[model samples]
Target: MTYTHESKKPTAARREAQKAFREADAKVAMSEYERNQKAFHANRERLRSERLAREAAATAKAAQSESADHVRKKRIVS
Candidate 1:
């Protein structure tokens, strides 16, 4: 007679418990990922808005200076 060593599979209840723990851990990880992503997107949006406002202000200033120069040239011509 030959004796063989075999590995035993986990019982159904143990498998179920492992599955539940894995699912709970995955949910926690996903929530943390979502929170970080939201914060990143919010910061990016805020920076983009600030950049747009600065550009608008610069454009407005340039246009005002150009208009003033045009008026001065007209007065000189007259």
Candidate 2:
């Protein structure tokens, strides 16, 4: 009995399958990256808005106290 030696051959179907897999992987990666970026920006915006609100509240309170003090001082002097 004689056995034939194996030969290296490239197949079209295998190449097509490999190409499809690469494309699918790229799309999945891009989608995941976009999702992460969206979450990050959302969190950043939320933090910034919260900080601005706190600052505004503080400013309003300080202004009110200063106005009250001014009235008291004027009344005492007059």
Candidate 3:
């Protein structure tokens, strides 16, 4: 018996299916990108706030030390 081969031509239904699959894949990729972007922004904001708080604390400590030194000098002079 001779074996028969199927036609290689693509059908309309197959083309439609491929298009649908591509669209779905694109949507999934876009959503993942957006999620990553949001996480990056949130982390950046958190780090910025922490840095500001640390700087403010450092400034306050320096001011306090300066005031203490000034008072000590006054006591020594008097």
Candidate with best lDDT: 1
Clash pairs for candidate 2: none
Candidate 2, residues 1-78, lDDT tens digits: the string is: 999999867599988998999999999999999999999999999999999999999999999999999999999999
Each model's C-alpha lDDT? 0.99, 0.97, 0.98
- Model 1 C-alpha lDDT per residue in residues 1-78, reported as the tens digit of each score: 999999899999999999999999999999999999999999999999999999999999999999999999999999
For candidate 1, the per-residue lDDT at 4 reads: 100
Q: How do all models score by TM-score?
A: 0.79, 0.76, 0.76
Cα lDDT, model 1, residue 64:
100
**Residue 39 local lDDT, model 1:** 100
Worst 10 residues of 2 by lDDT: 6-15
| Clash pairs (backbone) in predicted model 1 | none
